[model samples]
Target: MPSSAAHLLSNHYNETRNEYYRQLDTASRNGGDILPFINYAVQGFVDQIRNQIKHIRTEQLRIVWINYVHSRFKTLSSRKDRRRRDLLLHISEFGLLHKNIIGVMALKIYAGKTVTTLKRDIGYLRSEELIEETLTGYFPNLKALTAFLPVQRRVVE
Candidate 1:
């Protein structure tokens, strides 16, 4: 699955290269300028590489976040504790966790658990500095992104 992106990108690059060569051949046969075709292909390559880099960085950030969550909450072994962890993970998917959002998630996931329990779980995550409260609602702390910075720096270098 991971290699799918690389495979698709490789196929795109090959097709682009072939088309560029074909264009160059046609322009040469017609005694026309080839600079535009060269420039266009270069731009496409640059854009594709930039997008791939962005995708890589995003994947790295996700891995770091998941690892951080797993390590920090490793002791949450019991079923109830796991539910709290699940609540944290699920809430992280949303932009914010307000009353309405929490209520909806509670109905879907909490089952026997109460809304207050869900709120308490959120509070616990806040105390752990894993999530932060804002004027709008709660969000996973941006501090977690720090963990990915070193890896990103290495990739950039």
Candidate 2:
């Protein structure tokens, strides 16, 4: 898809998603009175979403999906655990193993810590299978990390 069309589609999708959530909140705030009609209303929103998705090509859809994943990772990295979040941010952006990064220098400076301290965190992440240490450097298991994150699943209609 053309850039203009993709932008337009994204705008439209955001608007529709916001409107759907607003309506859902309004309906649910009525003290359970609107329970019976919630599914019907949601189905309408789902249909609208389906219509929007149906026109996009596979490559465009893949781009949108990746953007969604990246956005989710950004949100996940904003957690209160500063060290872990910083590590996650670094890995997601630079891709430790996959990108053929050198030693701990990249994340070491980012965390403002010495190699020893960073190495501990790296070891922990490796134990958790979020990263792997090789002769080259530490690399991230992006697919595994993404799957492990508690991101909300999309509701398909």
Q: Each model's TM-score? A: 0.68, 0.35
Cα displacement (angstroms), candidate 1, residue 138, comes to: 2.6
Give the per-residue lDDT digits (tens) of candidate 1, residues 1-157.
3654456545555768877677678778877887766676666655676678889877776677777777777976887677767766766666467756546554556787776777777788888888888777787785757754864443432
Colliding residue pairs in candidate 1: none
* The best candidate in terms of TM-score: 1
Candidate topping lDDT: 1
Error of 2 at 149 (Å): 14
What are the per-residue Cα lDDT tens digits for candidate 2 across 1-157? 5553445434544666876566657778877677545664555555655665655543454454346445545655433345654675566456554434345456544445566666666676677665666676665555543454455457763
Separate clash counts for every candidate:
0, 1
Backbone clashes in model 2, listed as residue pairs? 97-139
Which TM-score value belongs to model 2? 0.35
Q: List where candidate 2 sits over 4 angstroms from the true fold.
A: 1-80, 97-112, 145-157
Error of 2 at 151 (Å): 20
